[model samples]
Target: MTPKLELRGVAKAFGEKGSPTRVTAVRDLSFTVAAGELVAVVGPSGCGKSTILNMVSGLYGPSEGAVLIDGAEVKGPRSEVGFMLQKDLLLPWRTVIENVEFGLETRKLPKAERRRIARAELRRIRLEEFADSYPYQLSGGMRQRVALARTLAISPELVLLDEPFSALDAQTKLVLQKSFSRTLSESGLSCLLITHDLQEAVIMSDRVVVLSGRPGTVVDTFAVDLPHRDDPLARSTLPATQAYVKRLFDTLHIAEGAA
Candidate 1:
């Protein structure tokens, strides 16, 4: 079967089309995510991780190589793909359900149909009771859950999450991570999570890919072979969990004391 997502000999550069100042952000990078798999990419600051996401999302085309989803080239943003950012990016004027339905508004979907899907998504996230509440009224974690619901409302075949839980408090972050893991598994969704947290990557991903320093390239890859992969708190206490964490830190040359 074709992979859910694939990048072939992918290289990206920035600056003018023919300027000496142009800098290459990524070079000879390639990877693939199978259907229903969650892959995490972890790298240092300014590693061009977001660059890869933008290229895959069709927001920006790579200078060389290709990004293909479901065996088709990603020429532009398509409904089959969903992107969730660090911020909720919910409109305060719009209620929770309204925010969830916002993406479908441009699809020419019927009003009743959009509402039905949005309501179902809210129910899935256990936020049906707050469907009428505005963004400001919900806690940070709740807002993020609504954001996740919004992403799912469109029924994306693949989801790209860029630091989705980085903004929340430690406790809230862990809880939401577990919830997200369970939801994604139950939904059989394919996801690519971009996070800086080594522990989060180990706990949430089926595989973790570490990138080299700036102008990033795939430096190392590790498979997370732990039971109950969705439980963030429980996974943290496991010996294998620390083992993966240690390996990642070692690859990045980050002192264990600093991590």
Candidate 2:
């Protein structure tokens, strides 16, 4: 089967044309995610992790190479790709249900059908109770759930998640990450998650792609081969899991001022 998403020789540079100060965010970055697979990208801070996400989302074009979604060249933003940034970015002025329905309105989906779909997504995230609540009234975790619900409302085949749980506390982050992982798995949606948490990447992704700093490039790739990675309890006790985590830390050397 053709891959759900593919990037070939993808590279990006910032600054002006003449005498340009080239900061190659991603160099010859190429990968493919099969339909229904989840992939995580981990790197240090300011390593151009978000830049790669932007390139994939078509928010910024590559200076070279091409991006393809389901065998078609990605010229502009496609409806099939759903992106969730670090911030929930919910419209405080709109209610939970209204925020979820915002995408449908832009897509010009009908009211009755949109409400039906949005309600289903909200229920999936267990946020149906907050359908009428405003974003400011909800906690950080709840607001994120709403954001995830909104991303799903559009029914995108590919989900691009950028540090979706970074801001929450340790407990809240773990809770939301588990919920997010379960929801993504149940939906069988292909995802590319950009995060600084190695453990989060290991627990949530089938494969982890590591990037270099400054002029970012794919430095290494590892498959999560732990048993019960999907189970929160099993993830911590497994020896193989701990080994992989150590290996990743060593490779990135985040503890040694690699970032």
The CA-based lDDT of model 2 is what?
0.85
Clashes of each: 0, 0
lDDT by residue (tens digit), candidate 2, 3-66: 9988888888887666567566767888888898888988878777888788778887889888
Model 1 residue 83 lDDT score: 92
Which pairs in model 1 have colliding backbones? Answer: none
Candidate 1 segments exceeding 4 Å error = 254-259
In model 1, state the lDDT of residue 14.
96
Leading candidate by TM-score: 1
On a 0 to 100 scale, what is the lDDT of residue 89 in model 1?
90
